[model samples]
Structure formats: structure tokens, C-alpha cells
Target: MDNRNMSDIIESYLKEILDQKNQIEIRRSEMADLFNCVPSQINYVINTRFTIHKGYKVESKRGGGGYIRILKINLLTSNDYLETMSEVIESDLTESEAHAILEQLYGNNLISAREFRLLVTIFDTKNLSTCEDLNKLRSQMMMGLLERLAYEELE
Candidate 1:
């Protein structure tokens, strides 16, 4: 039996389609039916998995003929991704959000494994438990990393 849960299976299915093309239009009800799940489950997966920060753009339409459009944003080309990612970081960032950004960078080969590990270590809340505002610290570290990436390309 597969150990992965419903959400993982559904996400993989959608990504499989996305790999073939940059965009896909899906009906929530149909996706739920195909996966033997409820429509709300489909909504949950889309909302969480397909986010702008994670390199996906999602558009949803509600009602009888409603559909969800997912576009895999290909901003990974060139150093522009670093600049774009820098702009997206807010004043505060949760650990999960930080990991998402790091994972995206590593997956896109923008950062080497060593750099990825260094960032992950620096951003770990456990290492910064003495600080009252972990999120703010994380945001600063992320921005610093983005700046370093841009500077690295200049060398």
C-alpha cells in the first residue's frame, strides 16, 4: 500500500500534468471525483500547494461551470528569480515559508546544496530561540541571502 496521503497523490497528479505544459485548467469537482475525495479537499490542496511563492499562479472560478487554472511560473531563468524572490519577502516570515523559498531555490539549481544547508541552519528557529521575534530575523536573513546571490553573480 502507498504510504503517501490523499493530498500528496492529488498534488503529484496535478504536477504530472503541469510538467507536460506550463498551464492547466482543472474542475474542482472532477478532480475530487477522480481522486475519490471531496471538492473541499481539492480546494485545500490547490490553495496550499499552488502558491505564488512556490512558483505557481492559481486562478479559481466558483459555481456550476467553475474551474481552477494553475500556471507554473518559470521565473527560474537568470538572476531575475533572486530579485523577484527578494521583493516577495514580507517584514515577517514563518519557518515553513522560509523553507518553501529555500526549497524552491535549491530545486531550481539557483543555490548549491551547501548554500541551501547554510541558509537552513541560519534560519532555524531553534538556533535563534533567544530572540523574541523569530519571523523578523528570518526575513532579514532571507533578504541578506538574496542580496548575496545577486552579488555572487557579479564576481
Candidate 2:
């Protein structure tokens, strides 16, 4: 009895392929046929799951012989990735946004699993519910962590 939704299953299936390679190319119709789903369902999965902020680059070829290409992006230097992410972190952070940022860091190997879990705990909305200005506090805390990470990269 798997409670996972179709999108989760589809995303997991695609990620398994991505783990073996930096990129994957597949036909949309073929994917739908394999999964016993509609092409639009495939589109929805790709559109939401394979997003840029999630550190994925997606390109598609249209018309006959069309296919989708998903690439897991990598940076030559970790600092460059951190700098880009620093800019991406919003002034008022939401829990989902923080989770995405943390996941990106963990996925890129910039943060260890322990650090990721700790950060996730700290940034969880429930933990910050008592704060008067939760977003502001979370933003400042994340900025501090980002600065610490950047500084550690110098050593």
C-alpha cells in the first residue's frame, strides 16, 4: 500500500535515472505510456518537479521525434553555487522556500546530511511560530549560515 502520488512516483522514477547520469532524455509520450498516464500528467510532473531552483535544467524538443532533456546542474566551484543561492534566498523566507534551498545545498554536497537536518529543523515554520517576525528572523538566520558556509570555503 503505497500512499505516494503519481507525481512523486514519476519524479522518483526520473531521479533514479538522473542519479546514474548528469542528464536524461526521454520522449514525453513514451514516458506517459510507460507510466500509464496522460501526456499532460507527464507535463505537469516535469513542469513542477524539474524546476531551475531545484537545480535542474529542462529542455524539450517539439513536433515529431520530440523529447525532454533533464540535466542536473553542477558548478565548478562550491562558492559560485553558494553565491548564486545567496541571491536567490528571499528577504522573507517561507518554510517551503527554505526547504528547497536546504535541499539544493544538500544535493550539491555543499552541506552534510546532519547540517541539512539541523537547518531544516531550525527553519521549520512550527519551530518559528513563537517569533514575532518569523520571516525576518529566519531570513537573518539563513543569511548568517550562508555567510558561515562562504567563509569556511575560504579556509
Tell me the spans in candidate 1 whose CA falls farther than 4 Å from its real position. none
Top model number, TM-score: 1
**Best-fitting candidate, measured by lDDT?**
1
Give one digit per residue, the lDDT tens place, for model 2 in 22-116: 99999999999999999999999999888765877799989898889999877778787778767866778777767877898898788999999
TM-score for each candidate, following the candidate numbering = 0.89, 0.73
RMSD (Cα, Å) for all candidates, in order, is 1.8, 3.1
lDDT of each: 0.87, 0.86
Give the runs in model 2 whose Cα sits over 4 Å from its true position: 1-3, 61-67, 107-109, 130-140
